[model samples]
Target chain A: MKLKRTIRQVFAIAKTDFLGIVRNKTAIFFTLLFPLFFLIIIGFTFGTQGTGETSRIQVGTVNLDGNMIDVNGTVSQNSTIGDVFVQVLKDANFTVYEYDVYGDKDTNGTAAYDISRGEIKIAVVLPANFTETLSYQYTDSLGIPIPTRAHLDLYTDPSDPTGSIIGQQSLLGFISGFIKYYQEIAINQLPENLQDYAEVLADPITVSTSEADVSGRQLRWIDYMVPGTLGLVLLWSGLNHASVAIATERTKGTFQRMVIAPVSSITVLAGKFISSLAIVYISAVIMLASGLLLFQVNLYWNVPAIILAIFLGALSAIGIGLIISSIAKNEEAANSIAVLISVPLQFFIGAFFPLDIMPEPAQIFGEALPFTKLVYAMQDIMTKNLPFEAVMPEIIYLTISGLILFVVGIIAYRLSLKRL
Target chain B: MNLNDIEIDAVTKRFEDTVAVDNVSMKVAKGELFGLLGPNGAGKSTLTKMLCGMVNPTSGTIKVGGYNIRDNAMKVKELLGVVPQDIVLYDYMNARENLAFFGKLYGLSGGKLRDRIEELLKFTQLDEKAVKRHISTYSGGMKRRVNIAAALLHEPQVMLLDEPNAGLDPGNRLALWEIIQTLHKEGKTIVLTTHMMDEAEELSDQVAIMDKGKIIALGSPRQLIKKVKMENTITVVPNKITPKLMEAVKKISGVKRSYRAYDEEEKIETIKIITERAEDILPEVVSGISSVGSKILSVQLSRGTLEDVFILLTGRSLREEEQL
Candidate 1:
């Protein structure tokens, strides 16, 4: 009879609380819209990689080189080898803007100014002797022709970190290819016996690259971020919402009414947990749906595993919220403290960035956070397409930690009941 | 045999350094409409909460329906219906929804819960349209009625109403008084706490006047007035009340006490002459004041009431205590 009554009371409380949240505009905004806002913003910002869509990087080029002879000693009327190199950059997915270099003026400075103004991500300067040196040849004592080396300078914008790295890499790769093309032409002009030695000397140690098969499909930045975004949604729905629940009730005088009822405090808390768990799942669904529909994120659905992970993650998040609610004197204080804890917690738990790139101590701290484990478990199941067994350790950690924190939360709630 | 429905023995509640409910003992008989009368913060609400098992007494025992609150708190709670001072219902939910939610918490369900909710909605005189509207949109009186209705879903034997008529206009207070009287007529024991002296005198079968965490006087309103031997008051509002006029009134035969009292609400001063029979002393008092060169504007004779009883017992007006 007691167990039946407890179940009935819990459901009653959950039903009322859920209805209250549905009707409350502020609650609806935080639970559904806030996290969706983050997902959409982050998704559009970094979701172009695996979708076969590429945005061109803008680069400023300063060509001081005069029209000089090519390797065949023929001069072009309108363009030099520096123009050919600029054409190579355009072909390699760069929007190149050419900066004119007058007699001894600083043309590199002009390129740098465009970079600072956000018009370009990188600046490239070609020396006046660029084509002359590449075409210059001399006979050694043994009467063998030797080529002179050419130099190029690149200045990258520090503000756009990712763009700077991509610009630098692409420019370097193009220059290497250009040098190899000229080397092949030079080698072909040599005698047959010496040509093989020249070919070997010019390109000694060729390197080839291929992407590793992680999940049978290429993963984009959106795919990696979807799970982290889900964790963030849970943090707000479970932690922030739960933190203010009891304080709001106290302020509204409902807490005293509940206490006066012939119901245990733990039973009331269980009802609150059930309502918050429902909210967590609703928020998670909205996040996943937005990711799949808006960004076309390629992730394994893994419904049962995802449900289990969210349930456990909500336990930890709500548990921490209960602790905060117990400590705060009122609803406003509870809300302020929850935001103070949750904002920094998102970064620390790798909800927005990868923890592996952080320092050792920070990585350890992230590893210890329950939300981080949820993010990792989600990444494994969604990105890696791993089975349940692959994430069993994370599941076990979440379950144990969630249970421990929930127990502590119950104790704190009971203490708060006494104060009330 | 315990004849009382509620018994509080040497109950005290302290918070840190302050004592909210000092060591006190009282018994409320079965089916009695008991009033806890005091100004704000006189520990009436604290004592009511202790009886409801919402607050634990620092010492002693409270028994409701023969169940000790310390050992059988749930049993005590099961027998009591609590209507808190603040409006405790979810403002976003309609009246029926709020009632149904609380009904389920009391272990009522299915047809029984539905029937109880319907009965309460009808009993509170909330129409279908009113029942469908959210509590936040309801008037203060309507919300107070629903607040009381939520506590009645379980049909508890004892009802605790902490200032149920507080902040209500005279019409609403009369309506609530009718509800309380109806409940009392059904033989349900009730403990009502309020700072309003007239509410206590009008509704209580017995009244306990508490002050500084202690019960200063306890009995029926008439019994208390008689026990205190309070004198009838003859109020004379003259064109002007002077110290010499008040002294002359005090020297009149049959006059026991005379003092000039200011009416805060009326913004006027009057001289009150306390005597055994106000009718016999009224003419003499009026003449005494007029002989002292004071022109009589009005003269009235009235019997001592609960406020007079409170003033006689504590030498402080109930209204004065409210200001403090």
Candidate 2:
């Protein structure tokens, strides 16, 4: 009978609190719409395509090649190799811009300026002697012919890290293709006996590449970010909301009423926890649904693991929130403090970025956060499609840390009750 | 000889260097309507909180419903209903919803909870439309009514109402008094704390006047007034009250006690002279003020009451202390 009463009391409080949130417009905005707003903004910005057709990468070209050719021993304009190279780049799905079209005289300076202004991802400068070098042929003392090599200068924007890598790789692939075409022509011009030696000399070594099988599905940036976004949603709904629950009640004079009731303080805290957990789950679900529908983020749906990770993550966040609530003097103060802590914590926990790219100290700190553990576990289950046992370490860490912090939160709540 | 419903012995509560309830001892018998009257910050609410287990006494014991609060807090809590000074109901919920929520916390459920909610809403005299509207939209009096209704959900034996009529208008205050009297008639022991002396005198079976965390006087209203041997009080409003005029008023032969107070609303100073007979002192008191060159605006005589009792014990008017 006693346990039954306690359960009833917890549910009663939870029901009332949940109803209070639903009725309050400000609460509804923060609890449901705010996180979805964030997901929409981020999803559209990064998750535009996944293994499908993509927009062309913008490239700026400063073609200074004179187009000089050794035709019958007279150097005149015959074949324009620079124009051919530019056409090659455009054929490879690059939106190429020539320096002369922009009326720029200095080649290197024009390329650097365009890259800085974000007008182009990368710049290619074909040197003035490019064709001349390719046309030059020499004979050693043994009377053997050799072709001169030409160098193409490629400049990538460092600020745009991902775009720079893709731009450089694409440019290099096209350049290799251009060289092979010229190599075949040169070799065909030689005698049949020298053709075999020239073909071997042209390409002595090669590299073969294949992608490692991770999930057997092509993943996009949005796929990697979906779990992190869910963690972020949980942080706001769980920690930010819970931090103000007790303080708001105290300000409204309801905390004293609850304290004077037959219910224990722990029971009241448990009720608040249940309410916060429900909100966290609701926000997480809405965020995931939005991601799936809007961005078409392809992720493994491990329902049980996802549920467990969210529960543990929300538990830890609410534990921290309770501690803040106990220390805050009023609802406004609690809200300010929660935001001050949560804003920086999102970055530190790798919710917006990856920990591996962060500094070592930051990586260490991020790896220790409970939300980071949740993100990691989610990534493994969703992005990598790992089995349940693969995320056990993260699950264990969250369980232990969540339980410890929650116990401390209860102690703080009890102390606050005494102060009241 | 009724059994005591509440017993507080040597209870003291301190915050830092200030003592809120200092060595206070009192007993409230079952079915008794007890009033704790004092100025603001006079420790009445602190003592009431101690009785309901919302606050712990620093150095003593409190027992409610025959259970020691320190040892069996939950048991004591189960037997008492607390109506805090502030309106504590959720603003977004209507009367029925708020009552149902609190009812469940006290272990009521199903048909019982529903029936009690309906009964309380009607008993509080709320109209059907008012009952259905959200508490945020209700008038102050309606909100106070619901605040009291929430406390009575479990029908506990003891109810603690701390300044329930603090901000109510006179009409609403009278309505609240009627509700409280009805509750008392049903044999529920109640402890009401207020700084309004008339409110204490009009409603209490017994009144305890507190000051500086101590109960200076305790008795029924008539008994306390008679115990102090107070007689009629003559109040004289003067155009200007100077120190010399106050001294002359006090020197009158029939004057037992004299104090000057400012009427905030009237924007005038008044001298109150407590005496065995107001008629005997009225002529001399007016002449005394006139001799000091202070013009007398008006004069009135009234019988002694609880405010007189508080003035006799503390030499300060309850209303004056509250203003200060």
Candidate 3:
């Protein structure tokens, strides 16, 4: 009979809170509209970038070298050493920009300005004597041939250190490829017996690549982002809405009325918990629907796992929201605090960007937050179609954290009631 | 005390260094309409909160319906209904929905809960046209009526009303008083707190007058009035102020004390004559003052009221304390 009464009380509070939310036009509008908004905005803005599959870095090139060289008695017009580098950039999935030739001026400054304005990421400038200097050969006094080198001036925007590093590496790879091709061409012009011997001297060693992935299918940014977006929706519905709901009850004195009733504090907490979970569950469905319709994301046979992930994510977020509501004096304060906590968690948990691309400390911090675990668990189940064993760690971590926060929320709420 | 419906034994609640309810004790018999009369900050609301199980006293015990508040709090709460000073109903929900929700919290459900809600709506007279409208759309009095109906849904034996008619106009107050009296006629033990002396006198079977966290007087309204030694006064606002008129009023039979003061705000000189029987001597006093060539602007014959008892015990007027 006692347990039945508690359940009845919890249901009563939950029904009231849920009715309050669904009946408000503004709340209903946000619930139905926000997930679609997030999906379209984040999906289109960052999802379809390079070759319509992955996000692409941008690199720019400026050929100041009127340095045309003749190959096999044919004049190579408008094709300098810079043209080869641009081709190499395009091959490496970078959208390359070719700048027009100008007189002696600070071309590096132009490249930096464009990068600062977010136009191009990195730029390179070639000197006029680039090919001429490269064609000449020098030797030591011992008669061993010394290979001549030409300077390829590479410039990058200091503001985008990551983009700059990518551009610099691509330039180095292009230079290595050019040297290998030049050696093979030179060797082929020799006699058959000498060609074999010269070829061994020209290229001594080579490297091979072995590629691996979580699934056989190539992972797109949308696949990673869809899970993180689900996490964000969880935060929106559970943290933001739940905190405001509790604080509204507090301000209206309804919370005190409940506290003074026959119900226990645990029943009150359970009511808030169930209310937020129901809201976030609906929001999760909306997000998944948006993902399928807007981004054509494949859920496959992972609907159950996805639902579990969403439930765990909502649990943790709602627990944290209750903690905030207990501490805040009013609805406005609760809203401000919820935003302050959730927005920062989004950044730290790689909700908008990839965690691997960030600095090591940031990755460590992101790994510590529950959102990262939720996103990874979702990705493992939904995108990779992994078995239960593969995703159990993330599920366990989320459950434990959620439980701890729930206890803390109850304690805080009781303390606040006592103070009142 | 054990047989009483509500018993408060030396209950004191303190916040930090300040005592909100200081060693106060009282007993309310079953079916009694008990009134707690005091100015604001006299711990009347705090004492009500303790009875409702919302607040825990620093010391002493409170028993409601034979259940100790400290141990069997839920049992105590189950037997009591609290109508808070503030309108605690959800503004977004209609009257029926609010009543149903509160009723469910008290473990009422199914057709029983529905019937109870309907009964309460009819009882509060909100069944006419306001049952379907949200509380935010209702007038303050309507909201107060719904708030009361919500507390009555589970049919608790004890009711605690904290300043129930506080913010209502005179018309609404009368309407609310009627509802409260009807509830009293149903034999529910009601403990009410208010600063209004007339409300306490008309409604309460017993009154506890609190001041500075202590009960200064405890009795029925008539008994409390009889406790004061001072007699009733006859106040006269003369059109013209003069010492001759004041002397003439003071010379009347049975007039023990008389004083004249000029009120600067109203620009009127008032003469008050305290007599053993002010009502019987009214004609003689009025004729004497008029014969002295003073025109009477207003004449008020005052009797000993709860307000008088409060003043006699505390040496301060109730309205003066309310204004402060």
On DockQ, the candidate that comes out on top is 2
Q: What is the C-alpha local distance difference test score of each model?
A: 0.85, 0.85, 0.78
State the lDDT of candidate 1 residue by residue for A166-206, as single tens digits: 77877777778888888887788889999989888887888
Q: Tell me the tens digit of each residue's lDDT in model 1 across B194-250.
A: 888888999999999998899999899999878866648787789987778877887
Residue-by-residue lDDT tens digits, candidate 2, A274-318: 999998998899888988988888899999999988998887899
Candidate 2 has a DockQ of 0.80
Clashing pairs in 3: none
lDDT per residue as tens, model 2, B37-56: 99888898888888888888
What's the ranking of the predictions by lDDT, best on top? 2, 1, 3
Fraction of native contacts (fnat) of each candidate: 0.84, 0.92, 0.84
Using all chains and alpha carbons, the TM-scores for the candidates as numbered come to 0.91, 0.91, 0.83
DockQ of each: 0.77, 0.80, 0.66
lDDT of 3 at A327: 91
The DockQ-based CAPRI class assigned to model 2 is medium
In candidate 1, position A222 carries an lDDT of 90
Q: Where is model 2 more than 4 Å wrong at Cα?
A: A49-56, A66-79, A101-116, A135-204, B264-268
Residues A1-420 of candidate 3 have per-residue lDDT tens digits of: 888878988988888989888889877755445655766787887665422321255666677556555533445434455466566657756676677642223444455556666677666777654554454323456655556566776666677686677566666766677778767867877799999789777766656865466566655667667777777777778888777877888888898778777888788878878888888888777877777777777554577777787787777788788889989999889989988887677777666777888899999998987878888888777778788679999999988887787678777777777755
True-vs-predicted CA distance for residue B237, candidate 2, Å: 1.8
